[model samples]
Target: MKALLMLLPLTLASCMAGPDAATRAATAPQADAAVTISSTTLSRQHWQLRDAVDGSNRRLDALLGLPDKPLQLDFSADRISVSNACNRISGSYRIVEGHLVTTQLLQTRMACADPTLTQRDTTITTVLQGGPTLILSSAGHTPLLTLADANGRTLTFAGMPAADAHPGDDGDTAPQQP
Candidate 1:
């Protein structure tokens, strides 16, 4: 009876070891259906912010303010730089399982007189710091990068091809003129 009890625990442990090979194989195709965005794909362009939404509210126009300088996110091999109109934000980012994860953000300490620009800066930093999941897709001929936050806020950007990317620059530099 003692030997049987010991064997029973071992059996239960094995059962709790998670999905077996057969189960994994059955779901392999479904998992593969989620196309992973490669570093090459991400690094191949400069992404310009097209629109931003906070919950159900459209915040792009307000974020852009007067004269309308577009916000830009540039991704290199391991770093991300954001041109948030007035101040620049830089960070390290990684893609895992088709999601972009950002960390170690460093932003310039420039003070803006305009309250709207200040608010926009705060909003951009908040969204980036949230480590939103990126959805990489295409709209017609344009490549799109969508950062979706946990609170349902989303920022969408349009990608300009590597050929059209800024001359004499990679994405590592903070605040390159747009």
Candidate 2:
């Protein structure tokens, strides 16, 4: 009886120490797993804001511009730099499964009354609360960044900026540094 009781505690402890099979299957691949994405991989992935139905409004518009030049995304150990046609924006980013969270974004403050950029920023910040799948697609004239779900459905949002402006139009619109 004493030996059985001791074994029971050991079994329980082991079970509690790490994820179970189901948990592992459901969770995002960790940094080590082959499924994990490297900075190079993430930079290469095509992503777009969710659609208007999913809050793809003014903010998403301002963040991305016409694809005249391929948008340059420099992914670092903990931060991201995107060279939109008008401005250079940098922020901290994290990925879970297929979802990405960008925080504390600091953009070069140039005067563009284009409401879309402001709105796009707001939308991006708000939608981070809702999980969205990150998909990279290059089928269109511009690279398409699809924010979808596990089932591969793009979340519909509102207020996409017209493909008029460049992202790096701000005073700091220079080539990004290494």
Candidate 3:
């Protein structure tokens, strides 16, 4: 019930979404670079954090800037909601100058058990607000979404279509409610 309340705005926004959003994410495996990206395409799956790294390939998942759980991103027509943030994080998003930009970010005031998580909201907020480069591609059968900031840090997500993904399908230790 609580989760539903958090998602209500996203649901409403999606109802107002366009059939498509401006296309383009980033480089892919040669052939898929030209793949089209629409609001519909983006909202098609539940993107889970697969890896977080820097240009040096240093893993940064420990500083996920949220609760100790897999980070999940959901897209509506023009809005994006973040899960595993302890509190809900959402806002309007758009493509500007070939980058994914998030604005008007709002987060619930719910407290988190981990001080590290709570204190790092600024980290994630800063990243999202930085207008990171968006890249979408696929590996075999699964879709991959990547967001890279100017600082060379990246957040890559693995797409899991709602119809094809189960609660524990990809070794989810902490499952977030929708």
Candidate 4:
């Protein structure tokens, strides 16, 4: 029958519609558990840049320049502080729908004469301003943080316990040399 043939396609389409709201709701608890695990992992650590890639997926090592000191990120209950070689940047951040959104970012005004340091700092600020999606995972025994922007650029970081982060209590002064 012609009517039956037409209805057959409609039925098949509905079958391919994927999981409905009820099914998603039923599995939300599991998803929430995973998110909680990830949040705990990230919150307990301080992270440092491992590598960076541009929107074209090209490695940005040349542009980033050689680091004279470790670049770092420290996360607290409400703020993130960044030490990008020569300058310090801080901002408030919140996790929403599994994404880290940074707001009210502030950076030190100290002028750096080194072009390389200035360029690297500018790139870091630009990436942070884009509100990249955060992905936390582990490789071997090391924790990794990957921040991917909407344009496909990614910055990967390796993390250590917050207690081991460099610089002093204020995250501005370098540790005094013996």
Taken over the whole model, the C-alpha lDDT of each candidate is 0.74, 0.49, 0.73, 0.70
Q: What digit string (tens of lDDT, one per residue) describes model 2 on residues 26-132?
A: 78533323233434444433333334343333333344444343334455556766544244577888887667677866777666565555554444444443456
Per-prediction TM-score, please? 0.67, 0.40, 0.66, 0.67
Cα lDDT for residue 124, model 1? 78
Sliding window of 10 residues with minimal summed lDDT for model 2? 156-165
- Model 3, 120-166: lDDT tens digits are 46556767888887788778777898888988888888887866444
Lowest summed lDDT across 10 adjacent residues in model 1 is found at 168-177
- The true-structure Cα RMSD of candidate 2 reads 11.8
Model 2 misplaced stretches (Cα beyond 4 Å): 1-36, 45-74, 85-87, 128-131, 136-145, 149-178
RMSD of each: 9.0, 11.8, 19.9, 8.4
Ranking by TM-score: 4, 1, 3, 2
**Regions of model 4 farther than 4 Å from truth:** 1-40, 62-64, 164-178
Summing lDDT over every window of 10 consecutive residues in candidate 3, give the lowest-scoring window: 20-29
- Which structure is stronger by TM-score: 3 or 4? 4
Across 94-161, the per-residue lDDT of candidate 4 in tens digits comes to 77766778896898888988776676677767777777777776677777888878877888888877
Per lDDT, the best of the predicted structures is: 1
